[model samples]
Target: MSDPFTFQMLVNYLIIGAGLMALGTLGFLSRRNMIVMFLSAEMMLQGTALTLVAFGRYHGNWTGQIFTIVILTVAACEASIALALILILFNRKSSLDVTLWNEIREPGQPAIVEDPAEAEATEPVPGVESYPVLTPAGIEPEHQTWTVHRD
Candidate 1:
């Protein structure tokens, strides 16, 4: 509770946070695997949280801690959603590569081809987008009546 956060310690925390952010950015950019990319995003979140906690500690306020909690909560939700989606994606393609999604574009859309020089570490594939088409259960609402005009 009375721990003093010296300038040196603050700087170290900031530096470490910055490093984590940079690493996460790099990994998110260079990797094509969905899981890996998500992991990188988590890393970035952790880094930002770390920086927030450091600042909050230095200022002797709960703002940083509160923000960190929110960040962690968001990260957890994101991870859970991402994992579920990844499982679905893996089931569809039988792999965790990201490049396979390039083909799921509009008609005549050029396939997304990653330059080997830019990101040679990831894999690739071709795919189509499919979604359930739902029919209206009742009478459609009129769009004109839904509009609100303010004078």
Candidate 2:
């Protein structure tokens, strides 16, 4: 049998779980991409699961593991539904940007609009290409034209 979890181990697990939750929250709130936001939400769920497992192990009970399993089931279902919704939304908007779906906001809430001037004022980073440069490899093959007789 494995040695029981020490107090320090429990504390470490809790700290790591909390960190994951914090990062997930930040990503969810700051990112505009639907996929990224979904991943962030998943991260948060995983963090909670981790914490639950740690607690359950520490207490020598099956409750935490059971809860984690239940959470995993719910998360799987949520992922499928969320993916379908994202596909439909992408089809409608031709983009995964969350801001494009302002119409779906609460009825009484005002739409948030970004200032065009501020957007235009932002400058690109100096001495950095927006895309990666791939080195060319090998020589190009020679092409030959062929004439075919009609059947």
> Which candidate has the highest lDDT of all?
2
Worst 10 residues of 1 by lDDT: 122-131
RMSD of each: 14.3, 10.9
lDDT of each: 0.86, 0.89
lDDT of 2 at 135: 94
Residue 135, model 1, lDDT:
86
User: What TM-score does structure 2 among the candidates reach?
Assistant: 0.73
- Give the runs in model 1 whose Cα sits over 4 Å from its true position: 1-3, 105-110, 113-151
Candidate 2 per-residue lDDT over residues 46-69, each given as its tens digit: 999999999999998999999999
Cα deviation at 64, candidate 1, in Å, is 0.5
RMSD of 1: 14.3
Could you estimate the TM-score for every candidate? 0.68, 0.73
List clashing residue pairs in candidate 1: none
lDDT of 1 by residue, 78-102 (tens): 9899999998887777767788777
